[model samples]
Target: MSKLLKDYLAKSLQDKKDRGLYNEIQILDGANGPMIQIEGQELVNLSSNNYLGLATDDRLIKASQTAADQYGVGAGAVRTINGTQRIHQELEEAIAKFKGTEAAIAFQSGFNCNMGAISAVMDKNDAILSDELNHASIIDGCRLSGAKIIRIKHSDMADLRAKAKEASESGLYNKIMYITDGVFSMDGDVAKLPEIVEIAKEFDLITYVDDAHGSGVMGQGAGTVKHFGLAKEIDFQIGTLSKAIGVVGGYVAGSKDLIDWLKVAARPFLFSTSLTPSDAAAAKEAITIMTQSTELNEKLWQNAAYLKEKLAALGFNTGHSETPITPVIVGDENLTQKFTKRLYEEGVYAKSIVFPTVPLGTGRLRNMPTAAHTQAMLDQAVDAYEKVGRELGII
Candidate 1:
């Protein structure tokens, strides 16, 4: 390696370690479920995005296997170039129906979906009003679009209205769009969609919602947009199949014209290989299950409520989360890492999130209580938290 490159790498890695911003990725020996094995130690997992525990569902697994057997392993090429399979169309149709949209288009992943979709529509001649705490993908997509990006305060409807009005009235851009996470991932607070819709109507701003963490967990499994009856109000509805759907990929559900445009213009769909046959089939089946039953969603809410109540009773600052994501803010980055290490020692695999994922000095242990986790498992995790919190003086 070049000496300059090696020195830069060494300095950067050391800086992260010194600042306690370095995260060590753990390898799961088995499937990601309510519980996981790390380095031979079995621990209750509270760090997955699989909100419905569908990642390990028998039905999805069987669907995946069947598709693999019938369609082979991969789609073989880009969607526009002979890779669009019958299963892909079916999955998009299921997504469209689930989202109550006239049409939908599948993508390789949620990040890629954002990257392609945003840039496909907006450009330097336009402006985007984005929530400050939106996912990195949204931020990158907005940047890639070359749109003048204006950041809005997190869920502050007044701030959003002001910004939307400012941008729309400025007469500096051809198009003005507003984008936010349907459900904020880090703190679990939901977007104020009703007020946003009202403001958008007043300003005539195009709307986009990234519901990565809300799908299958909100609106009896439809999504946040559906939860508030804003399906027809919002212009763009985005969801990740990898989240509650327990599969791997993403989709954008919208009017047939929007989808038709995306099919021809989205760079990722036009260039990247299509989602594998097994993944597409499994995702479609997962959506079907979510549509058929609310049992899993109910259980997920129940477990989350129970976990949040227990954690609060134990004196941990869980913030204002409206969903199943429970974040125990530890304030200091190194201390948060130490707290999670203690939890791991006590048989809980709660991970620490810090720095770029959130603001500095707000390091936290982000716990995900899924539908698959039983009260018994939750109790066990809380027991571990209690022990660790007391030992670490966090309680």
Candidate 2:
């Protein structure tokens, strides 16, 4: 390596070590279900985004296997070529039906979908009014769009309206778009979509909602757009199959015109290979499950409510969450990491979020309660939390 790179790497490693921020990765020996095995010890899982427990569902697994057997492995070429398979079209149709959109298009991953879709529509001459705490993918997408990005205060409709109006009245941009996360992943707060839609209408701005974390947990599993009854109003509805859908890909649901435009213009969709037959088939099955019943969604909410209540009663600050994503606020980064380590030792696996992922001094332990977790499992996890909390003087 060059001297500069060597020095930078050495300093960065030293800095992490000095602050006790160096992370030791642990391997999950098996499936990421309600319980996971780490270092040969089984623990209650609280760090996954498998909200509906569909990641290991038998139907999804069977679908994937069947597709692999029928269609072989890869798509074999970029989508612009002849890579698009029948399963790809089937998956898009399934997603459109689930999201209540006229049509949908899939990308390699949620990150790419954001990058491809946002940049494909918005340009340097436009302005994007985005929520302050939107996901990293949205941030990257806006940056890639080369749009004048105006960040509104998190979930504050007043701020959004002010900035949007200013951007519109200035006439400096060809168009204005308001973008936000359907569910704030870190804090678990739902976006104020009703107010946002009203603001977007007033300003004549396009509305985009990235529902990566909302898709299998909200609106009886439809998503935040459906939760707020704005399915047709929102211009862009982005979702991830890797999370609740139990597969690996991302998609954008919108009007037929928008879907057609993206299919032609989005770089990732055009240049990158389409999803594997197995992944596409599995995602289609996941959508079918969501459409068929609300059982998983109900179970997930029940577990989330129970966990949040118990944590609050124990004096652990569960941040302003309206979904299954729960955070145990511990201000100091070192203490937060230590708390997570202790919890793992006590047979519960939760991850620590510190600076960079979040802002400085707002370190936390994020817990993801999934549908697979039973009441007995949750009770055991609560007991472990109590023991670890007392041991660390956190409660």
Candidate 3:
């Protein structure tokens, strides 16, 4: 429209292209499953966040349809308004039970859950010790909180302890909080929660864990905190229902007091419309499925292990990942893009992670292998990877 706005947009686009940071998005023609149809080509899917394949489970679909029939498609208003429906309350209760927490409160999405939860509890007078490799939402949330944020090196307990000690003894802040991703989405590394809990107790610092990528993939589906048996130690446990829960929404699980506070103080919960009845019902059913059996979880791990071993044998450097989130670290940005293209051409759909998403010079293909992927699917993906890796000389 305006000359200045047009110039800025043009320069930004040109810069991204010149730097090989701009990614052309591909549209999926059908369901996001183990095999996906993109641009009329069927490919073995390895980029979805559906770790347990519950997104297309018949049970969750039935629950969603039943709730949609019983209730309207939408919540109609914010929770404080007329949106605190029975289904919504039931979903929260199910989340609390799944997370092994005293209570829980739901949000429209995981990104805002961090945004709202952090700002609601911490203030400018408080200091938050955060992991350097945390999700962007956590970083934005800390900024929104107006808290003095001290970054700790990725999973470095020494740095965390030192920062916590300095902030605690400074006598400059009334409260200090420690926050991290239970399972980092990029590096796929698990946070050192046990050592963190010890550090939190040592400094009397508040603890928060956003397990957005770990809910259905870790701790036997309870999450990373419960996986480490530290449920009672962490003050706040946040997660997303869209990824592993196979629905759509976010939540914070903690004490009854914490849930009550979020209900009153979190701006998103107060302003944004509540989740649809179908989503709430489906999410609850997904949680129920995870709790009743570990079948999906076990299958997911098996697939992850099988794929990782295959990729390693093929000579692709998978940077330290403990979860199902596999990364093929292809150092250069252009090379990363080229590798992704090769994989896509060979019938695998894995995306490239580059500058702004991951640090510069660390561009990679972030693979997400889920429970729905059969041995044959994984084998097919591995065959594609082998062809691409040898062609690129990345092996």
Q: Candidate 1 lDDT, tens digit per residue, 250-295?
A: 9999999999999999999999999999999999999999888899
Q: Tell me how many residue pairs clash in candidate 2.
A: 0
Q: What lDDT tens digits, residue by residue, belong to model 3 across residues 98-203?
A: 8999999999999989999999999999999999989999999999999999999989999998889999999999999999999999889999999999999999
User: lDDT tens string, model 2, 50-160?
Assistant: 888999999999999999998889999888799899999999999999999999999999999999999999999999998989889899999999999998999988888
- Each model's C-alpha lDDT? 0.94, 0.92, 0.94
RMSD of 3: 0.7
What residue runs in model 3 are displaced by over 4 Å at the alpha carbon? Answer: none
Error of 3 at 63 (Å): 0.9
Q: Model 3 residue 5 lDDT?
A: 100
Residue clash pairs of candidate 1: none
Please report, as a residue range, the 10-residue window in candidate 2 with the lowest summed lDDT: 16-25
What candidate 2 gets wrong by more than 4 Å, as runs, is none
lDDT of 2 at 116: 97
Give the local distance difference test score of model 3: 0.94
Residue 32, candidate 1: alpha-carbon lDDT: 97
Candidate 1's TM-score: 0.99
Q: For model 3, name the residue pairs that clash.
A: none
* Candidates 1 and 2 compared by lDDT, better number: 1
